[model samples]
Target: MTDHATTFRRLHQEGLLLLANAWDAGSARLIESVGAKAIATTSAGLAWSNGYADGDTLPVERLYAAVESIARAIRVPLTVDAESGYSDDPAAVGATIARLGALGAVGINLEDGDGTPEALCAKLDAIKRACAQAGVDLFVNVRTDIYLRGLAPEGERVGATLARARLYRDAGADGLFVPGITQRTDIADVVAGTSLPVNVLAYPGLPAAAELAQLGVRRLSAGSGLSQTLFARAAELARGFFRDGDSAPLSAGAMPYPEINALFAQR
Candidate 1:
């Protein structure tokens, strides 16, 4: 646990946190196979797996179960996207964080300032109290979605961005995740606003990895992009099969028969 704490805290260096969001144990292990520093659970990813909405539709129990399965599959530090902390209550958020700790979640990303900024604040307050009551050193990476889903009309993404960043920081957030922060100036402003390391989502036609590092972005999450891309690729392949009306390339690059047997080779 201490090791994960140090690692989660160390992303502030020039080093980048290549956090690949996973949906299940298979995906989690596959990411670990290719070498990812840590794993972040995407609510959308998990929701799709369970056939639900991307928001807080998934029951708390099911979410924790997914985290437990992923934790068992990977060796790296696991960060969970505890969407809205399951409820608006602070005690619930803290209880959820404690449950995550029991299942091996070393870090958590709690978002506030979505619409009711006061509610977000209340939830973060609960998370802090719960983490303390539970005696778990869960690094709460408080995410503020104002810039991403709630842009302003006066072209003040920067203003809204800075305001919410400070709000979460003061609410006991260990780090800040500012989604939709594409502009260099906006990201720089967020970094300047708070001492917490800023997390940015990977977007198309945006700055490169080097650029984000230059802007002081320590943690970079793929968010739902990876899952969306995989879904698009699968759709394309499925359409290809429908057009071909016969055998396709699905089995061409698939694991060999021996590899299939290897799933149970060493238990």
Candidate 2:
């Protein structure tokens, strides 16, 4: 666990760490097999996979079970997208994160969505204390929804994000995740303003990986994009099967049964 924690933290020191977020054990193992340096969970994907909606609606116990399954399935470091820590009380949130860390998660993405920066700071402080008490080393990647939620005007977005970043960093954040930020100048400004590694979500207008690296971006996340695509494809396949009972489309581009079975079999 210490080796994984150290490696997960070192991945952000230089270059762009591309995180193809996974939702389940199967997805996580497949991602690791493809050479992913680390596995980060997508809260949206995980919720949807478990028959729940995205946001803070999913139960924390369910999240713990999911994290445990993913951790057992993959050898690389695991990071969870614990949306708002699933509670308003800082202590409860901190305890939840500590449990995840104990379940083999080396990092977590905690966001401030439609919430005050001070609230997130309190949570971060509580998390730090809780992790210390539990002898857990967790990389708390603080996420600000200024850009994602349109919390600021076009010109002031960068400044607002940086302001939140500073608060989070002071409160013991290891990285800063700014979703929905796409412009090069805005990305660079946020990166330069804070000492924490800057993480950006994959958006339509986001720059290429090489360009993002040159602009000092440290991490790029696919968020729920891959899961959304898979959901759409599943819907299409179901519709086609229900309409014509054709089995061919279902197997199109599908991984062979043996290959998929091999993943769980090895475990």
Q: What is the C-alpha lDDT of each candidate?
A: 0.79, 0.95
Sliding window of 10 residues with minimal summed lDDT for model 2: 258-267
Candidate 1 lDDT over residue span 105-216, tens digit each = 9888877645566777777787777777777778888787777786575377767767776777788778888777787877787777778888898876558888888877
Can you write out model 2's per-residue Cα lDDT over 1-267, one digit (the tens) per residue? Answer: 999999999999969999999999989999998899999999999999999999999999999999999999999999999999999999999999999999999999999999999999999999999999999999999999999999999999999999998899999999999999998999989989999999999999999999999999999999999899999999999999999999999888999999888978858
User: CA lDDT of 23 in candidate 1?
Assistant: 84
User: What is the model-wide C-alpha lDDT for candidate 1?
Assistant: 0.79
Q: Which candidate has the highest TM-score of all?
A: 2
In model 2, the runs with Cα more than 4 Å from the true position are none
Candidate 1 — worst ten consecutive residues by lDDT sum? 258-267
TM-score of each: 0.91, 0.99
